[model samples]
Target: MVLQRPAAPDFVKRVFTAEEPDLVWAGDMTEIVTEEGRLYLATVIDLFSRRLLGYPMGARHDADLVVAALNMAAATRGGDVRGGIFHSDRLNSPSTRPGSSPGPAAGWASPSPWAGSARASTTPSARRSTAY
Candidate 1:
């Protein structure tokens, strides 16, 4: 039998631009293959400045890793992410997971946005410079 996953509410609606920092934030996860094993990297970025607000790597790709990244992002902004929107393709599971509270109660806006299939194209550029 095929089971259907609950639909995530759309808050972004394909609009990925943010006029100011903290107004819109996006998160994504990547898997890295290593000699020893695979590692997961979770990142949170400020859509306006295209700045990487949070990044956390771990052996497991679970809610804990996502939460750590979110906490780091919040801490990066001085623990004040009260009214900002956080969009992500893989957040629905973590957010709805039992005992997880990575939403409004954690200082972020309610009904977090989901990027779904457009995650890749909508995510901010990750280019880096050699010079500091």
Candidate 2:
């Protein structure tokens, strides 16, 4: 069964501000159509650099996929993710729910903005984004 948590108090409005790298991160999941089938890709990006910190793909779009991505991000940072703020769209997915995450040990506080930018900030590579 899906877990639930009380309504969260948003710490971030529309601002995606961060003082330093690893201070704040944004994550999102999207379905990608491959030749074989569909894959759910969960990615965590460091807002400061707009670099993809972690990305994990799974057949199921469930909490496990999100957790795997989060774990990878933490590992990339040497497991010192304390005081980091993870922002994402507050979809009613099992992965995005409060108290359902396994990242509290790292002291990461995930705040879901009313709306969030799933795409990374404009970068040289971002120009390749397709309109279709």
Q: How many residue pairs clash in each candidate?
A: 0, 0
TM-score of each: 0.69, 0.67
What is candidate 1's lDDT per residue for 1-132, written digit by digit as tens?
333344455557678879898887788878899999988888989989999988888887665566677777776887766567777774445433433533222444333323332222222222221111
Q: Model 2: which residue pairs collide?
A: none
Q: How high is the lDDT of residue 10 in model 1?
A: 52
Candidate achieving the largest TM-score:
1
The residue-level lDDT of candidate 1 at 88 comes to 76
TM match of model 2 to true structure = 0.67
